[model samples]
Target: MASEILAQLQAQKLLIVNPRRKNGLIIYKKYYAEFAGPGAIVGGQFDCDAIAVLPVGKISLIVPQTPEERRQAYKMRRQWVKLTKQITDNPIPAERAQVILNQFEHWFDAQTVENLPDEAFALLVGVLPQTITKVRNNGLF
Candidate 1:
C-alpha cells in the first residue's frame, strides 16, 4: 500500500518531503565525507565506505537532472566547497570558526544557523564538533 503511494508520487515527479529530512547524503570516503545535495549527481562510488544521510532536517531532492542543470549545480557546489575550504584553511582555528559562523548566520537566519547540525558544519569548515558547539551555542549547540 505504501509502495503504491510512493510509486504514484514518484511517477508524478513528486519528491518525498520529510519535514525532518536532511538535504543531502554524505559520501563517506576513506578519510573524509562529501555531500551530495539537490542537482548533484553521486555515482560510481562502489569502493567508498558508505553514503550516510544526515539525521533528519533539511530536504534532499534526489532526482535526475539535465546535463545543463548538472553542470550548473556542479559549478555552484564546487564554488561553495572551495570557499568553505578557503575559510577553514585559515591557520587560526578561532578565526576560521568565526568566519564560518558569520557566513552561516548571514546565509541563513540566526535560528536556522542554530538548527544546522554541528558535525556537518564542522566538517564543512574543517573544524572540530566541539568548536562548533562552542561557537554556535547560546540557546544550545
Candidate 2:
C-alpha cells in the first residue's frame, strides 16, 4: 500500500512533505481515474478505513484529510464557538450581553479574531458573570 501511494504521488508530481511515521496513509483518488484520475498503473485494492474516489483536483493536500481528522476539527471549532457564545451571552445581563456580543461581532468583522492572544480569550472567559433569570412583567408572562 505504501509503495502504491508513493508511486501515485510521484506520478502526479505531488510532494508529500513530512511523511507520517506510523499508522499508514489515507489516499485520495479521483472518482474516475479513467479520465481525470491518474494515468498510471495501480496496485491491488486494500481497505483500512474508508475508500473514497473523489473527482480529480478535488483535493490539494500537504497531508490527506482522514474522516476522523475532518470530523474532530469541525467538532472542536463548534465547541470553541459555543463556549465563546455561552461565556459572552447567557450569563451577562441583557444590556451587557448585547455589548459583549457586539464587541465579539466587531472583532469578527475586523478580522482580528485570528490575531487575538490567549490572554484576551482567557480574560473574557474569566470575567463572565453568572446567568441572570429574566422575568417578564407583561401580561404575556
Number of the top TM-score candidate: 1
Cα RMSDs of all predictions? Answer: 7.4, 18.1
lDDT of each: 0.52, 0.32
Writing each residue's lDDT as its tens digit, candidate 1 over 33-99 gives 4544444444322212443434222544544446665556556456555767788689876566678
TM for every model, in the order presented, reads 0.60, 0.23
Worst 10 residues of 2 by lDDT: 32-41
**Residue 101 lDDT, candidate 1, scale 0-100:** 72
